[model samples]
Target: MNTGIINQQGLVFLNATGAPVLSRADSRQMRAHITKSNFAKRRQRISQVETKGGESNKQTTQQALHRRKRSQQKSQRAALDTNPTELPTTESPPCAPSLQLLRNFRYLVFLDIRPTVQDPVEKAWFDLITSEPVVFEASLAGGMRCWGPDKESQQNADLHLSRATNLLVDRISCEQVPSDAMIGAVMTMAFGERLADNDVAWNVHMEGLINMMQQRRHHGVSSLPPVFRSLIALDFMNHLLGFPRFYHLKVVDMLSSHGDQVLSKLAPIPADLSLLKTAVDAPETGHMGQTSHGVEEPLERVRLATRALREFNDPYVKATSRSLEIYLNLLWPLLFTIDLESVGSELKDAMSEFRIKACPYMDLTSPHYILGLLATEKDSEASAWFLDRIQGSVQVMRQRGWSDPLSVMKRGLVHEPHIHHQFTALLDDGINGLM
Candidate 1:
């Protein structure tokens, strides 16, 4: 006999006769329904927890990304704060006009090489012209006058010129020994005056410059800077134009000794000069070569000229040197000597040969080439014809806005007390010597 408790589907019993009541299928079904309901409830609770965890994980990830972004911003700010030079300042960036003006000045004065920082003199000169407002304006004036000769540019140039002059005068009074920058400023002013065609003003600046340079020499600064090379070229032009030189003979010689070195510093010799081989191969020539009845001289003049030309890597420097060579070697003797009969024909021939060999390598736009033309012409007609060609070239240069230092230095051979006058006298009057 089974003694057990049995319940109906929705009720509980205290006691019952077991086997008949417990064996019902509906009771077991009811229990199974209750178990299925409990499992559904548990699954609902677990899903709710997982949904909350997902939301929390997304928020945490977003917060981490935001922190990282803010840290990067702080780092960037810190970098900017530390680098002072990179920070913005009150000074405005160089405008197109100033940059263009500086470019013009560079092309006119430095022959487009722009001064190298490796050279102290060039660096000093470059800094003055590009950084100092007054000196920059003064330097800019030359380019302005040369490029277009516009009235507005001229007016601006004059304004800058007056200011620069005052600055130079004030500085000279204060400093016992003028600095290189000061000398450069004065040189710039003199260049401006020259462009303005103010001989008296230019002369005043030159005199001041001479005194300053002399003081430098006395202070044991014997080596002249490369910037002085341009001054020397200008001085040579002055000599050619019959103006008395301001530089003393000793200074000229001292500087002359280092001229090649100075010029080599200005620019690099091109790695591949097509004409270099041609110049090197040109036949040995001159009176020196005429020795021993057709045996070439060990010191061939053509070779010497080629070597001299190579010494100056820049075309501008070469032109300046060429003009100086003509002035010293040929013109000086011809102008100062008492007798043409005493002047050796070999001297003229050597110079002519040098000119021929050196001509192929020169920048034809250079006014220095005109000096060569003038010195080598055998007759007045040829001189006049070349003069006409030069005038034509000058007109073209003016029309096209070209800047050549020598042409400006001599005022294109058209100004009063020009070199052409002396040249014409020598050729037309059959004058043996000016002295």
Candidate 2:
């Protein structure tokens, strides 16, 4: 049996019909070629479809853009229709905002956050940009950050404050019943005076505001908005400082409502003092009677509240708290001054105690220091001390990157006899009725 060798490509197997057949390798090549051709055709079809879809998508995008442009135009037209005097336009390049406007913006932003105006206090505060002279001047007064750094700005602010006071007086006299806006304006003026450390002026304004609210029959704290509650909290603190009780509502009632939470957190006066007193006196009043030990209990609570103030992360808040603490200590030397037998008779003890305990770098030229001296009946000394510290205060504030270095010194300047006539009156009449 002789077997003949055949080339792999040429090798073939005969079918049952005895016909010559393609080798397995040749069959595989044919099938592969067909499959590749089919794939190429399928890919070409897909590419064509994708191209058409892309064109359709481009058209759709163009249509959408056109519609948006039309919608914007319609909005502008509507705005134009609403306001005939002002032309409707898109947001233009912001030119430099006026200083007053900038200040107003900052104030509005501040009002939106905590430790300022919280809750839906009223819609009236948001409507302050009206033509009302009281509102305008009040805004200028409240915008403390804008004008505190310089003498010129300060003078301008004073002018605005004067105008605001005049306007407020007129409004109060004219209106049969006080409006919320008017009330807010008066409160704002009082707050501004407080910030300026014009104790006499602040009390005066605050008294007037209370009178106005009383006239409005807001005897109940619940009748007023949360804004007034915050005001009442301040008044309560003022009461603790020896001012007559301006609020009829108990401190507990005010605290129970939504008010300045920060003040509540750090108040020197506890909310339930009256309740505690009542309970201690009449044990049958409530379950809290057992807890009401004595004045020491309330005093301990006050000390605890003040601890949170010391732990404040904000340096500004801490400094303000320290200043307030020093003021409280300075208020009643007979009651609070330190003695050999007891820790002190006063709220924070004698000025000597603070001198020893206070940080050496503390701003002695601060409003707290000068006012403390004035309250202690050391006017001549306070004036001299304030004058000496004016330069130092300015330098320190500037070093701290404050835009309003002069404001820090000027806060105490209002107490100078040469600077404010009220200071002279304060000296003559004392804290009760200087205004």
Candidate 3:
């Protein structure tokens, strides 16, 4: 059959017989078929277009990329918040001004005092001189004993000098004194007797007294009467300088019961040129003020304490060690404020002696006084000397297997300049020596 458009209504097809056929359908009917077929085809094309548009959207791809980025960021944040070791953390607190001051002062004192000791004996002596009292009585007695000679003679001569001395001898002879106490006492008496130019017999007497004080200080015996201790300290100071009653009383009254009180008392000591000059050039008495410097009477009062320290011994030694420690602790800052250069050498020697001989038994606070004095000095040479000595000491300590040697060195370096360089050099030398 030949199919062709017919009357614009439907498709006509020729039958097998090639004759004209008159059979035909209504126009509306044929038109309906045509419309239906066209509508179906158009629907198919619309569906194709919609499918293509849907395929082109790409929303899923963009969403997936966004999701991956978000996931990565979440992982990074988790990692950042996680602390591995499970250790607790604390916020750093503010620095304490007083503590900083003390540290700076200690560094300066170490620098000033590390010299003048050629041997371990001097070093040990220095340690004993700077220790704090373990016993309340020792502390109280020390304060009183540090005043002047008159007070020492009045209060401590009978108890500490005579009675304590006898008891100490019996204990020492019987070997009843504990080893540490025995060593401390022997050292104390040796140093004390030396200061007083005492011979062997006096030294023997001093040994016992020294032991008793050391033991008491170490153990912190609080039963000691405060008044008795104060009187003992004043008497010790008096004996040290042979100062008269009036001068001793004046100085004794100035001593305070606590560290703060001692520091407050130091505020009034004169720092004028006259005082400085007298301290520098005072004859045979030297810094002791025994010479006729013709200075004000009050200035002499200030000097009395120093004089006592220079002449400290067992009979009147009650609190001189600790008392002087407190006194020096307060006095250096005042003196440094006035004239650092003149006082620097003397301060250094005094502190060094204390650190080396007395620090192990005495208050560690005393060294800070020397440190304050060193800070006041402008001399680089002196500073270098100080640093070198500290480095050497640290090395020695480390070689002896001392714990926290580095800490000790670091402590020495704190608030100091160019210390790292000095320490590095010293450490290298120490390593080489060990090798």
TM-scores for all candidates? Answer: 0.41, 0.35, 0.24
In the range 51-88, model 2's lDDT, one tens digit per residue, is: 56666454444455466568876875664454321222
List the global CA lDDT of all models: 0.43, 0.43, 0.35
Clashing residue pairs in all predictions, respectively, total 0, 5, 49
Q: Ten residues in a row with the worst lDDT in model 2?
A: 352-361
> Which scores greater on TM-score, model 1 or model 2?
1
Compared with the true structure, the alpha-carbon lDDT of candidate 1 equals: 0.43
Model 3 bad stretches (over 4 Å)? 1-336, 349-373, 376-379, 406-435
Model 3: worst 10 consecutive residues (lDDT sum): 84-93
By lDDT, highest first, what's the ranking? 2, 1, 3
Residue 358 miss distance in model 3 (angstroms): 9.3
**Best-performing candidate as measured by TM-score:** 1
